[model samples]
Target: MKIYDIPGFPNPLRIRIVLAEKQLASQVEFVKVDLPAAEHKQAAFLKINPTGTVPVLELDDGTRIAECTAITEYLDNLDGDPILTGKTARDKGVIHMMQKRAESELIDPVGIYFHHATAGLGDALREYKHPQWTARAEWGKLQGEKAVAGMRYFDSVLEAQPYVAGDAFSMADITVWAGLLFAHFARIDVPDDCNALRAWKERVDGRASVVNPA
Candidate 1:
């Protein structure tokens, strides 16, 4: 199998952590994608993923998988002993629910704000990521506020549970962790009062996979 992504990027890091958790790092070859250079938007890369995103997974037989959730689902189940996703129906439901929340409420907003409101990735990728919209910066600022609200929402959720989905750590936790990471990069500070979220981040940061991902 081969994974295409830029290292240290938030979305890619999510899959790398999954690979580490599944102990599948050694089984895959990594192909670097030059995100800042707009390599993903080029014709060659678009053939693999029309969405033009990084962290795409290519199976040995030539099947390509895009999106972090899809890649994670494949990797987690490869050994027939899925841990990160979930083992039970209820767990799967909750994990997917929270995972969607993590993406929609937190990470997605931060990304919009980063690319539109700020000079994201410099001039090389600006034209592709940020178009000529008069109100884009204002719209991005609103999304940034939404992301902050998301942090507070997650903080409240964490105050009631050990993990995002429930007792056990799952893909939802990874999504939330990555969302927070992107939030940090976008300069969207978690509210000072979000103690539970901060504590959860500290705990997640100590995990072996997060500490040393693929």
Candidate 2:
């Protein structure tokens, strides 16, 4: 299998963590996609993923899987036991719910703020960007505000529980972690009162699966 992604980017980091957790890092070859050069939008890369997104997984036989969640689902189930995603129907439901919330409320907003509000990857990538950049930039700032609210919400959730989806370290937690990471990249500040979320991040950041990827 081959993984196409831009190193250090949030979405790719999610998959790298999953690969480390699943102990499958050795089984796959990572192919770097140059985002700064706008390689993803080029025809050669678009043929693999029309969406022009990174962290795409190509199976040995040439089947390509895009999107973080879909790729995660495939890798998690490849083993006899699933960890990050959950094993039971209820677990799946809750984890998926929380994961989507993390993306919609936090990660996506941070990404919007970074790309639309700020000069993202410079002029070479402008053609691949959304039209009406000025208006979108104003809108992106609002989304950054929403992401701040999301931080408070997740902080409250962490105050009552150890992890995002209850006691276990799941993909929901990973999404939030990646969101915070994106926040750092985008210059979004975490609420000073959100102590629980800050501490949770410290714990998650220490995991061997995260600290030292296979």
Candidate 3:
């Protein structure tokens, strides 16, 4: 198996964490997806992933599966019963719910703010240029602010639990970890006042797999 990835990108990080947790890092090959020059927009990549998103999984038989969450689900359930994602129907329900909430509440806003709203990446995303999106740029900045508030709610959740959804570290934790790291890099304040969350982030960051891959 192979994984199309980009370091510093949250979505790809989610998949990488899953690989580490599953102890399957050595079983797959990782191909770096270059976003600076818009390599994902090139025809070669479009052939493999129409959406041009990173973290696409390539089966040995030459099939490709895109989207980070779906890829995480695939890897988690490989051993059967969807342990990390959810072992029971209720677990699956809450995990998926919380995961999506994090995306909508925190991660998506960052993407809109950093990539679409800011003119920082003038030449990096050549293909995304459009009059409509240009007009919507200001919204991204405001959305980023909202994302910070949403993340605080997450901080509160972490205050009560060792992980995102509950005691056991699950996919939700990976999603939050990856997204928060990106926010940190983007100069977003993670509210140092959230003592519990601050501590949790430190612990999660200590995972060797995140700092070094197999």
On residues 56-154, what C-alpha lDDT tens digit does candidate 2 reach at each position? Answer: 999999999999999999999997699989989999998999999999999989988888888877888877888987798899899999999999999
Candidate 1 residue runs with Cα over 4 Å from true position: none
Ranked by lDDT, top first: 1, 2, 3
lDDT of predicted model 2? 0.92
CA lDDT, candidate 3, residue 56: 94
Candidate ranking under TM-score, highest first, comes to 1, 2, 3
Q: How many collisions between residues are there in candidate 2?
A: 0
Location of the lowest summed lDDT over 10 successive residues in candidate 1: 126-135
Worst 10 residues of 3 by lDDT: 126-135
Estimated TM-score for each candidate: 0.98, 0.97, 0.90
**Better by TM-score, candidate 3 or 1:** 1
lDDT of each: 0.93, 0.92, 0.80
Cα lDDT of model 3 by residue, 1-214, tens digit: 9998886677888887788778888889889988877888789999989887687999899978998788888888777756578888888888998899778888777766777666645586845654577566767778789889878989889878898888877888788887787777666778768787788888888977676644
- Give the better candidate number (2 or 3) by lDDT: 2
Clashes of 1: 0
Give the per-residue Cα lDDT of candidate 1 at 133.
Answer: 60
Angstrom error at residue 119, model 3: 4.0
Model 2 residue pairs with clashes: none
